[model samples]
Target: MISQVVIDKVLSKAQETASHSWEYGTVFEALLEYRDPHYSIFHDPFPGGKIPELTVEGVEALRYVKPFIQTNSARLCEGNGSSSDPTSLCIPALLLYNSTTSQAPDNPYLSAVNRQLHDLLSTTPRYSNGAISHRDAYPSLWADFVYMVPPALAYHGVFTSDIGMVKESVRQCQLYCEVLSTSKGYWRHIVNAEGTGSVKSDDGAWCTSNAWAAAGMARVLATLRKSQYGSETADEQKMLLNMTKGILDGAIEADTDASGLLRNYLDNETWFPEVAGTALMAATAFRMALLEPGTFGERYVGWATCKLESVSRYIDEETGVAAPVVNSLKEGQRTPLNGINPEGQAFVVLLYAAWRDRRTVAEDASVPMAGTDASRT
Candidate 1:
């Protein structure tokens, strides 16, 4: 398990940074940070069994993210123009808060929650095939959208017992996979199928983009498994599992750097080694190991462990910022070696939370198997 001190420093630094320090700023940063608490509390390894309490770090994470949730909930309730970007990533956090806290019948957040759901389902631009557009003007797909959009839908769906929302989440992933990924084990960064304008596409397999896609799918699978539809949707769950594994396989294989970290562009050797993507990729692998022990158990655990150790070396001892990351705002360029990357810090927190969860589950499995008399010794 990672030290609590290290996790604290990383999350604290990320929360203190400028709102625009990350590509999507407070919304993305808060969403990622909120997962540490949400996953610890909700993702039960044993569905019908007891779950553990939140770790100290998880409690602190909730505290850090609550303010953002409150503010965003209020802002959205004020009737902000319909969202067109990944701002919906923050909706899950608001949903979490609203459901857990006591509220009046006329609670403004109720409107906020309903408003976001309306915008996402009825207003967001989409390709003809039903993939949500990351931009408002054109029908384009971004690997990052997988993380921002689907998990919120799944979480909301499960929260409200609306199986249709959950199904839509799965459908979005299928559409994205059809356009952005290849069975050959890589997902392109972006695709613009129509509306020629200033819209751009990146054919490269950007490492962080793949990490976003994998981690997003992992969250969706976990949510589905814990939902009322878990049994009925086994086939869809399997598809999500396979899709996540394929992305991880390609990312691990693309680690051509002597440092054992993936490059900014997985296939482009000229690009610098990137710790943000490395951390998120490793985080996703740990998630896969936890979700499907039979398939990714030893295979992903070994690779993810080694990559995590490599990632740790890149985090600053004093400030907790992970360096040598690609500038999220300018995905084509590298951040200065000395500069701090907000998303990089958040990914480290995610990596450690996932490692801790898997480690706890592994320890639990050390007991006797179901039919064993080993307990009689």
Candidate 2:
């Protein structure tokens, strides 16, 4: 288990980093040193200059990301294009919304953006519809983007107490699963709207995509279980459980590396070293399993805990961050990739929070031993 002090330090550093990216009322795309830092829609200062203002959702994103972007005020507006897609913008907005203390006001613009996102999901063709359908768009192919949207949408639904929103979120999750599931109980790295699969150019399974699917399903399931609407039907519950099981089973089969950490690529051909994204994805799945304890809950919990511990061992304490330390022999044993991503940090925070909450409940005896045992090793 990570000590409180370490957790605090990491949180503090993340928060500090988040602050640096804020400027002119917007958070920059990233804090990579090569990127421009001083830009925001609010204070373009220059007339007809290239950078545009942050969208309303961008403003919303800042509410949560402010801590990390505060110090990097100069870079917020630099790279952002004038016309940003609502889907791409929704993530930071939702994160900001979730982290903030203020209640989401019933503003028309916010409502419109919410409705727009909903429309996008509804109109998008399902994988069952056709391989070249609308769902096979840009974000769908990218695991990171595809996985990020659901939690935000679920949070939006929960916060607004909108049953339709919740259901829509679940449906999108199902769609994602249907499109990604492999014949072998694994998920494909790239999927088409019609449910066809794509192989990585390198002939490897994208570990992060599978991880994202696993984590996304677990989160969606947890959210649905907590909703009053979620309790209305046995069919709903059964479907959710089945989906959860499928994802966990696939993740176990496809992603687990020899080091107990999940690999970023796999093919029964070779084991690649673990990536932080995959580790966090696995951690997210494990955390969700703990959140909703059941028959498969203990298995997910154990898997996540072990994966997190192994991954955490490589974290650079001096930087209060994690970096990839393992590489796949298939890739010729190259050094692992390293970076501190907000998504990764967010998952860590979530994992820590889940662990803390469970510990509290166990100490208080509110959670039955059976449930605890089922949730943890």
Maximum-TM-score candidate: 1
Candidates in order, TM-scores: namely: 0.84, 0.65
Q: For model 1, what is the C-alpha lDDT against the true structure?
A: 0.69
- The lDDT of each candidate is 0.69, 0.46
Where is model 1 more than 4 Å wrong at Cα? 18-59, 69-101, 334-338, 366-377
- Model 2 CA deviation exceeding 4 Å by range: 12-63, 66-112, 115-146, 155-162, 193-204, 254-256, 268-271, 325-335, 369-377
Candidate 1 lDDT tens digits, 63-97 = 55444433343333222222433344344344334
Cα lDDT tens digits for candidate 2, 1-377: 56656655555445454322112111222221001212211112112321123433434334444433211222212213111123434434433434334335742234434654554555544344322122223323434333445644664665566766666666655665566566665566654332345623232356655555666556566555554445653464566566656656666766546666666565453545664445545555544554455555566666666666776675566665755633221332444634454344444544555455444455666555213643344
In lDDT terms, which candidate is top? Answer: 1
For residue 11, give model 2's deviation from the true position in Å.
3.7
Q: In model 2, how large is the Cα lDDT of residue 318?
A: 64
- Which whole-number lDDT from 0 to 100 does residue 120 have in model 2? 51
